[model samples]
Target: MHDLIPFIPGSVNDVLGSLPFFLPEIYLTALFILVLITNLLFGRNSEKLCRIIACAGILLVIQRDYQQIQLLFMSGRLNGQFLFNEMLLLNRTAINFKFIIDALAFVLLLYFGWDNRLKSHPKGLSDLYTIVIGSVLGLHLMAMAVNLLSIYLAIEMVSIASYLMVTYRSENAFGTEAGLKYVLFGAASSAMMLYGISLLYGFTGSLNLFSGNLLPGLIQANPVAVSFSLVLVLVGIGFKLSFVPIHFWVPDVYEGASTPVTAWLSTLPKIAGFALLINFLRPFVYFEKWDGFDFKLALSIIGIITMIAGNFAAIMQRNVKRMLAYSSIGHTGFALMAIVTYNSTGIAALTFYLAVYGLANIGALALATYFANALDADDMNSYKGLGLKYPAASVCFVIVLVSLTGLPISAGFTGKVLVFSSVYGIYQQNHNLWLLLLMITGALTTVVSLFYYIKIPLNLFLKRTEFVKNTLIKSQNIIVLSIIISVLIVLLGVWPDFLFKLF
Candidate 1:
């Protein structure tokens, strides 16, 4: 019986260790099921209940995970490796730093719950909450997934949820059109990615990323084939991230989808997509094992093109959501610079940047939703004179815009500086003139971005336009969350080390 007692405790510890790492997902799963039941049982009034339950579930996970962070760090619990046979491994770096369900997700959840734009839908709110929980769960998994199969499943899960969200208002033509575009593009990309994965698996006979033994034979066999497979895989990731050349669907989709859903779509998928990029590139960083490939060079070229294209395209946009969509593409390019570094500092910087970026984006979208509701407009011209009518929300908008432009005393600036410094460190070590040029171009684009990002404030505050009075139904909860996020952005910009230590 004494020996049995020891075995019982050991089994319990093993189960607890595996379970705690997945707390957020477990909460989400329960919320999804409960919301579905509430929708079926309570009918019309279930929307509010569903929303509250979803928000509560996410909050509970955040609170529990945060309390564990100190312990995780102290015991170096943040640095474990759990392998599910030969296919998947969950590591501390992937969970704590990469799979982070932190302030960013919390802020996004707040935005999702507070945005009244979603209330415009005729269907029960339960459906929206289910999709949100499921999609976010997929995003969290995507960030931690280290195998090709897991990656595909994660992306598809998010993609399907996104399609439903886009077409939620199926009575409208725009919604149907956006859904079709998304489904077609998403399906094609997934097929290509699957084919690429098959090729990779055939060449290497393994899918586990951290094992680091799958690529040598492929690299020696045919460089062109390997590069082709890499490009195919990136195509799927780019579809999710909406990077240049593959970004054709973004503007239309953003304009068509409900604002809150668009906001969620823009932030979460990009973060996970970048995480997957970092995971995919980890083995190739040293180049000692694979001497023939130039993965860094490929990434640098893609980053340059994505940034330039996104910024230039955004400059011509009239719709605010469309412009933000393009701006997201440009930000993806900026984040890629850190990925090019292929080191811990680079990964840490990327993680920090995404968190700040997600918060800023959610705040900006919240303000946009308010403006759309108040003025019934989404064009840049409609923002004229908003500063006078909706002063608080307008001010928040300006601050978010400044942060997006990478201006001083904002989280955006901190993110930019971190990526810049990390890339410079890499450049200094290698003396790579090409990277230096790309960095220079990125800086120049930052200035160019300022012109467009500030156009909202300029339109709102400085321009003289007709006073169009409209109902500005302010949600106190959303406003407070925005203010909090804005303050954090400025605080992190000033004292970045405090934020860096979290990673």
Candidate 2:
């Protein structure tokens, strides 16, 4: 206690220094509170106003962060600086992730605003916006956190918001059930993570995961104990990642939640979660050999299993949302493969893949939602005979699905190429057979995905079913958004360098 007293204030100057770097998060929190007040005072009429406010707030933060990002990357200020006494990182990588998440939040806000189903309860829209904005703030925290305590806090913040958002449609039984499942699983994972943290702290007597003491302490400890604690800790990160073993919650939550909500769930948490994941493993870089408890090899194996499970499971899904749920699980595995590259090149690849994946995912889910609302259907069977009737929507769906399948002339293909190349590079440098097998599994799964991914287009164009009604549903907004996303996907495909250079 006496020794800890001296570390309390953390050099007054350091506290002040952290403020400047922390502006983006502070700005977001202030915006959240301001919007909440406005939401309450103005009632239903302020729903759209609050959305506008939220979008403007995120855009402002992005613009400010962009300037800082440029400065950090260009000026070489990222020489391992820590903020708030090593509680958070101040680096280009964290800034890049926050930018991506903020940008994604803006897109999601637009989605929530324009979605007719979400708009059913006017007052509820305000609550949803508030929750989403709060979640974005949590994402900012997740992006920069370096300490175990910070990591747990950020995860809880985002998880709580996600739990509520999944059940936003409280009137729907499926939505309620999904929310319950998420809450229960999240609680159990959080408890396990906290216990793991306590054990690690007891061993190391420090909270920082990447600090000097962590590895030394772990190395000195009993191997079985260290590995057990690490596995328990990883449970928290894996749930957010929705990879194999911890992935049981994804399909149900995705299928039960509204499409726009599902879109957010599929993309944002995974992005932030992976960022935290990389930092968590940085301490393990001290290993002198690949003989025992190799985090990289373990993750590679998990990635292989995840890709196989996700793709195979997707094939059996009749519901489009559930299929995409499984598809996302597959992509999660693919992203994990890129992760084990664990270097600058791998970071670039992972970042690019996530950006492209986020855009493509939102587009695909938007199209699905549009179809269900427009035709009163969510099954592949209902999509029969849709191509001729709704040419634009069906065509856009084809483009999104094609990108997702990693086909030619699309961003997803380039993303896959980048990830596989990174994985292969690791295999070459280290001669890790696990990575070799992972690369092969990734390739095979991509082929298998084609069968399921194409089912939508197949049902729309080839299979014939009785056309229920020729009447049109006004889904111009969804179709237009989907088309925009497809265009971006193709443009990125043709010039992968564009996004690659940015990251």
Candidate 3:
């Protein structure tokens, strides 16, 4: 009975002492409040102002954290230690992840504000910007969460904001429906995770995973029951990460939502999900330290299944947005493969892939909206001969697609190579059959992914059709942003060592 109670102990002083390391979050919280106030004071008219504020805040945080990350790299020291009585951590990893989230937010807001469709919405985009700022705040915390309660809260924050963003335009039935589906799925996952957390607290007698009694208690718990509960906790994570078996929500949600929303969904949440998952598992994977079940093996199995399922499913998609949705699911699996390596190399690889993935996916979805507006069609069939008429866009789209397919001369290729190297190193060390299986699955899926990704280029070039008037993505900023992102993707591919050395 004593073990059934959660032990959560911390003092006010502890939280106070941790404030210095929590500056990134504090900055976000302040900005969230400022955005809210700005929205209220200016209402719909504040849309541009709010966007500027949101982007500026995110950029500032990015600068601060990036500098900190650089300092940590140069010093070759980890600044993250347990903070707030070990409920949160402040380390180089968390900082870098925060930087990624903030940087993506900054870029995304620029796209969102520049998108004429959203800019023309009657209610305006002010509220949405506030919501996004809040969401990033949650994700920032999610990356740093080391306690069960904090993790739960962080997931809820992101989920709630995502639901709102999906349903922002009540005029769009597809988006509203997607929002409803997301809510139902999100709630169920959260409930299941809560139950799992309760079970963990019961077994370990502590809310903190690394607490004195938690690990030993976990080891002594019934292996079967503990494994089941642990997986239950991961249900929420898998949902966010969009891994297979828990990825049913992705495609429809991606197709139904607007491009900017889809880009944010596919990138930030997934990165934070994997970061949290890896952080939570660190104690177990690194040590023969605490083991009642083989979590690493379980993760490996999921990774393989996700890669095979996501890539194969993408082959069946004709709608470009939905195809990329499934493609994002495949990337989720590839990320898991990196996470499974359970070391610094794995972390570096994961970080690099996520950075490139964010850039390419954002650029791809942006191009999707551009094409949809230009051709007035969402399917591959509509894209025929578009390459001839819009050579620049078609070429850039090809670049994005090439990167997504893990082709050479793109960041996706470099990301794949890094992951393969990590997985191979693990196999060499352990000769683990499971590791071997994941590696093979990852490689084979990369080849299979080529078929679907090729459809875009094929449609643009091979199939011939006349171009329609496209008013959707006429914004010069959007076009320029897409090209710049594509350029960065190729740069990262060619100079992978540039970022790798920083890590």
lDDT of 1 by residue, 1-503 (tens): 67688678766666666665566667768877887888888888887787777777777766755654554666575655443332334554555543354445555655655655667666656787778778877877777677888888989998999898888765368767987988898899999999988888878887766665467767766778887887888899889888777888888888788777778778888888887777677666654677755778877888899899888888998889889988998998888888888788888888888878887887888888877767676888988877877788888888888888899888898889888999999899999976897799789889988878888998999987866765766576766777887788788889988878867
Question: TM-score of the candidate numbered 1?
Answer: 0.91
> Candidate 3 residues 1-503, lDDT tens each?
67644442346667776776667778889999999999999888898899888988888888777666655556555656677888877677787788778888888998886655556678899999989999998998889888888888889999999998877764377767887888899999999999999998899888786566767788888888888888998998888998878989899888887778888999999889977887788777765666567877888899999999999999999998899999999899888888888888888999988988988999988887677656556888888878877777788899988888889989999988998998888889989998999999999999999999999899889987654555544556767888898888888889888777766
Q: Which runs of model 3 end up more than 4 angstroms from their true locations?
A: 1-10, 70-79, 466-473
Using lDDT as the measure, name the better of candidate 1 and candidate 3.
3
- Candidate 2, pairs of clashing residues: none
On the 0 to 100 scale, the lDDT of residue 477 in model 3 is 74
Assess the local accuracy of residue 82 in candidate 1 as a C-alpha lDDT between 0 and 100: 46
Flag the better candidate by lDDT, 2 or 3.
2
Pairs in clash, predicted candidate 3 = 80-90, 80-91
C-alpha RMSD in Å of predicted model 3 compared with the true structure: 3.0
Inter-residue clash pairs, candidate 1 = none
What are the runs in model 1 whose C-alpha is more than 4 Å off? 1-20, 67-78, 97-102, 113-117
2 or 3, greater by TM-score? 2
Model 3: how far residue 254 lies from native, Å: 0.8
lDDT of 2 by residue, 1-503 (tens): 99887866767779887786788888998999989998999987888889899999999999978877765657567654578878888677788788889988898898886666777763559889999999998988888888999999999999999998998875478878888998899999999999999898888888886666766777777888888888888999998999889999999999898889999999999999988887787767645532335788779888999999999999999999999999999999999988888888888899998988988999988888788778767889899988888899899999989989999999999999999888888788888888888888999999999999999999999988864665446678887788888899999999999879977
